[model samples]
Target: MIKNIIFDFGDIFINLDKIKFANELQKLGISQNDNTFTPILNEYEMGLISTEDFINYFKEKLQVSSHEIKKAWNCILLDFPIERLKFIKKLAKQNKHRLFLLSNTNDLHISWIQNNWGMDLYNEFKTCFEKFYLSHEIHLRKPNNNIYQFVLTENNLQANETLFIDDTEENTSAAAMLGIHTWNLIPKKEDVVDLFTKNHI
Candidate 1:
């Protein structure tokens, strides 16, 4: 019996254009062959670097304005469907599972979300979860075993009874290795609102 649920924020909740970042970067002359930004990106996602420093790094490397860098960075984010919010709200009201949100996100992305989604809507989405964990805030990102262990230990949740849903296979697989149940949801094709009907949870 799944007594607790862990959800990923991106793709699972808000729709993302997965290729948007790469395309935007390509336009700015950064390509897959250019790995200069990869480490810094990982650092930013892990909260190891400040947002200002992050923007500065890009500014110096790309010789672009901060606004342009931010724009390209946030291009991956698209929209959050109302139905998904409704579904989570319904689940929250049920008081059934101990719900949690674990997302690999950074300060810039979150700032964009807050400004775009507005505080009211963001707060509404936030309150639905018992504990909302962000990578940057927690200094822990997904696909890392320690992060999974941290969530389980901190919440005092049994791995066997916790179901983690994410869009990334690596994240889901890592969680599965720790004996947690997982669902690597396919974006567009798999709507989280159909959790019960589709996954039979």
Candidate 2:
């Protein structure tokens, strides 16, 4: 039986505009082509590279200043609604199973988030999780066999007893391979707040 829920933060909680980001990057001379940039992003997400290195790579490729690159790169992190925060808190109050947040995020993004939301709000937000695992902090990222193993072994969680929800199929499939139940949510059609109702919690 599933006893723990691992939630991914991006599309699952906050909305992202792929088209907006692409258009913004185009203004900054970055390619919208998946062939060129997606693999670089994938490598960074897999914990294969450092934040500074990733930023530097973009800055050089796009021939833009760090500030310009930073703005364009961080365009995905838009808003955090009180309703979403309330929903997570409500889920936590159930006290039925351990709740965790696992995201493949890096230092620069984290620093930007801290600055954007400020420390107090971030702490309040983080309090909703039994454990908050950010890739840069843990030095382990998603879609990797070792990172998934780290979460289970370190937390003493049974793989079959955990359910991971992520927007990325790659990450979910990797966890599913380890016997963890997964929901690769399609945000365009699905409402995360309705998971409990639809999944019949």
Candidate 3:
């Protein structure tokens, strides 16, 4: 009796090139070995730091311009298939389940998405959900137990009756630990449009 659905934004709806950011940064002389920036990135994702501060930090540390940093940061985002948007919209219209969107995203990535997808399209996608929670906006990221608990408690949702779909194993596993059902959907090989047939929902 799954009455609630939680979806991850990246890979679940919009496509992402996971390695594109790292590759783009590499082209700008930043490598994986530059681990010091990781904490700042995490802070940025959690909304603990302002976007200007984030850009400035990278600009000072990497000696890069704001434009370069923004470009590299947004390289991971790709396409949003209209078919998937249609599917979610249809699901929302059914009114059979409480729909939620929970994504580990930041301002820059979201900004890029709005610009790429158009604000109207983005708003249409958002209106499909009862609640749209972004990590930066909520100050809570996925794979964190508190974030899952926060969503559950806030919505008064029963974990056993909630289905969470995410592209990351870590996120799915964390949700499962709280008795929620999850599908660690494989991107490219699987599409959210096949949710009913593939997951047998």
Candidate 4:
């Protein structure tokens, strides 16, 4: 029996336009592609670099002003829907499954989100989960086997009894390899609120 449900934040519960966000980076004169960008992002997510250092590093690469770089870097955060938040909370209230949130997020993005959503919105969101795992906080980012292992070990969860939903193929694939069931949702078409009707949890 599935006793746990792990959800990804970006583009699953919240909406994001990654391509649009990346295109915005090109305005700073940076070649925002995998070969040029992913390494820097990986380092930032791993907490190996400070936000200012991250901004400065990119500013130097693209010759963009600090302010402009900040704007572009924050473009990935889109919208969080209140209805979806309530739906998740309703699932938690059922008390049939253990709920967790696992997202690959960084300090700067989270700070921006907090400023926009405020403490109350954040509190309401947290109230829906038994545990909320942020990559930077735990030093375990998704698509890495270690993170899946960490969640299982820390929560005392059975791999076969947990389901992970992520928009990112790589993250879901990693979890599936660990004997956890995974649903790789296409961000644009899939709505998390539908999970209530589906009742797969």
Please give, for residues 1-201, the per-residue lDDT of candidate 2 as tens digits: 789989998888877777778887889876777577877776776667887898889877877888887887788787777777888888888888899999988666777778988999888889999899988777677888898898889899999899999999999999999999999999878867877878724
Query: Highest TM-score: which candidate?
Result: 1
Q: Number of clashing pairs, model 2?
A: 0
User: Of the candidates shown, which would achieve the greatest lDDT relative to the real structure?
Assistant: 1
lDDT (0 to 1) per candidate: 0.93, 0.83, 0.92, 0.86
Q: What TM-score would candidate 1 get against the native?
A: 0.97
Error of 3 at 8 (Å): 0.2
Off by over 4 Å in 2: 26-29, 32-53
Q: Rank the candidates by lDDT, best first.
A: 1, 3, 4, 2
Instruction: List clash counts for every candidate, in order.
Output: 0, 0, 0, 0
Give the Å shift of residue 195 in candidate 3: 0.8
Candidate 4: where is the Cα deviation over 4 Å? 32-34
In candidate 1, residue 72 scores what lDDT? 88
Evaluated at residue 182, the lDDT of candidate 4 is 87
Q: How accurate is candidate 1 locally (lDDT)?
A: 0.93
RMSD of each: 1.1, 2.4, 1.3, 1.5
**TM of each candidate vs. truth:** 0.97, 0.86, 0.96, 0.93
Residue pairs that clash (backbone atoms under 3 angstroms), model 2: none
Give one digit per residue, the lDDT tens place, for model 4 in 1-201: 898999999888878879878788777766655577787788788777788889889778777788888788788788898788888978888999999999998988889888889988988888889999988888778899999999999999999999999998989899999999988888767788887566655
